[model samples]
Target: MEALGGLPEEAVVNSHVLQFYFHQALAAYRAGRNRDFRQFRDVMQALLVRPLEKDHIMARRLRLMQFLSRVEEGENLDCTFDKESDLTPLESAIGVLELIHTEFAVTQETMETLREMVKEAAVIVCIRNREFEKAAEIVKRHIGKEPKSQVSLCWNERQLLEHCLVCPMGCWGTEVPGVVSGMSYRVGSMTPEGVRGFLEKHAH
Candidate 1:
């Protein structure tokens, strides 16, 4: 923290800076520096409004911070989707990002759904980016945002093996799924059944 403090203020103000601010605020909270925590927290919230920020893959995440800040302050949201964004509430949640202070009977229930959806979305983005530490950090910070279920996925040989790189820390389990599945064929690739037989012979 002291080393970071020695750098110019602009040093931490970059496209992917919120994670740093989030940690700084966390450190402040741990140190019992309420004012410093709030200051960093507020700065994180304010950064969401930058036009450049709105274009990134993590746009939803930046807005997510804004809503989280408001929620921390005990404010309620009537909507969660960005006013300027074309995505619907469902889309925003699916996109794992920003919406209105962000929530409404069925409408109200849907807000909770949105939160959960985005929680998973945030996890996916972290995992897809191979940010395992960040994934754990976020889950610890927002218990409600933790993934509700383990994920099961299937891919071609290349896709399946590549995900291993995403989990350098290693995971608890890996297994073949308990259902039959099939793949489609490209013009020149092996027949689907032939590929299946090949996989059976070379099965891991």
Candidate 2:
């Protein structure tokens, strides 16, 4: 492998060496060996940063792996790290989505789905961080300005948007004061017709 590193750029890019490193990284992650995982991740990332064909399967796979790794890191920080020092995982996740969108030639449907997933995840993270305004902005951006006409959302996406619009401080409000009032107002604003519009728009 060390000798392979000295090879010409074209030869290296065409080789299976990166795939081998990716598998090693994945194995380390699965086995819960943090040190080994980091080492392998670094190796794979280094290779991935080089110029590769956009349509290359290995390149796509590596991008997906890196995205998942960032998501996992974010989740781990959310659960175990100190709030004061831990970086925002959602931010990293969103960044990966942006990179994939701009650099890859994925199908339109796949791109839209990826965008929706990222927005949903970002909403959850912002809510947890008590950044309600940012959460609202994310939902609005994805749903569009004229949700009734332009935004066709699935049931799950609708529910997530609704939750983002109304949920305060990420709490579902189990008997908290003012919870019922706030929730009721938001729910009332969402009519059956509105939901029908969303469902119909996304049905295709």
Candidate 3:
């Protein structure tokens, strides 16, 4: 297969040849060969331009490999991708999650790792599109099973929603009372009557 790398561009664009490289890439990734995996990844990226189909296993695998490669390269999976393509990263990740659930009968640990990667990709896509509330929900639903300390991100859903509500301009550090402190402090800081009076006074 190494010899194929020297072939001319026209020859490499054949779907059969691209599929061969896709399988090779998948094998290298699964075998934990980082160098070989990257070599084949570049080949697929260069030659494969067809849209992915969810029901096609090889196509799905190639798309998964491409997504993971972007992630491994520290590229944002959220903002990139052809807008006219059939699947966005978020949609592709969801399809991958469904495939993992129904098609493969893997163990719990392996299942969790696959699910986390797809969910993380989805959340990052939401965040990049300025869908903070949706992103927070995705994080909570898919990735927030562990305790707060075990969760990777520093902020929780409430914190994220609060930031989205109050900081439209994206200045996160500015101090505001109820908004910053969150709803947990609402009862402690103001009585029912006081809250009503405050709202009435501000009503216009």
User: Which candidate wins on lDDT?
Assistant: 2
Q: Arrange candidates by TM-score, descending.
A: 2, 3, 1
What's the CA error at residue 173 for candidate 1, in Å? 59
**Candidate 1: worst-modelled 10 consecutive residues by lDDT:** 179-188
Q: For residue 102, give model 1's deviation from the true position in Å.
A: 10
Error of 3 at 173 (Å): 3.1
Pick the winner on lDDT between candidates 1 and 3.
3
RMSD of each: 20.1, 10.7, 17.1
Alpha-carbon error at 100 in model 1, in Å?
7.6
Q: What's model 3's TM-score?
A: 0.41
Error of 2 at 96 (Å): 3.0
TM-score of each: 0.27, 0.47, 0.41
Q: Write the per-residue lDDT of candidate 1 for residues 48-139, one digit (tens) a residue.
A: 56522234334444544443333232111233445775332333443332333232011444445445534433433344444445544444
Off by over 4 Å in 1: 1-13, 26-36, 45-56, 75-204
Which model scores highest in TM-score?
2
How many clashes does each candidate structure show, in the order listed? 11, 0, 0
Decoy 2 TM-score against native: 0.47
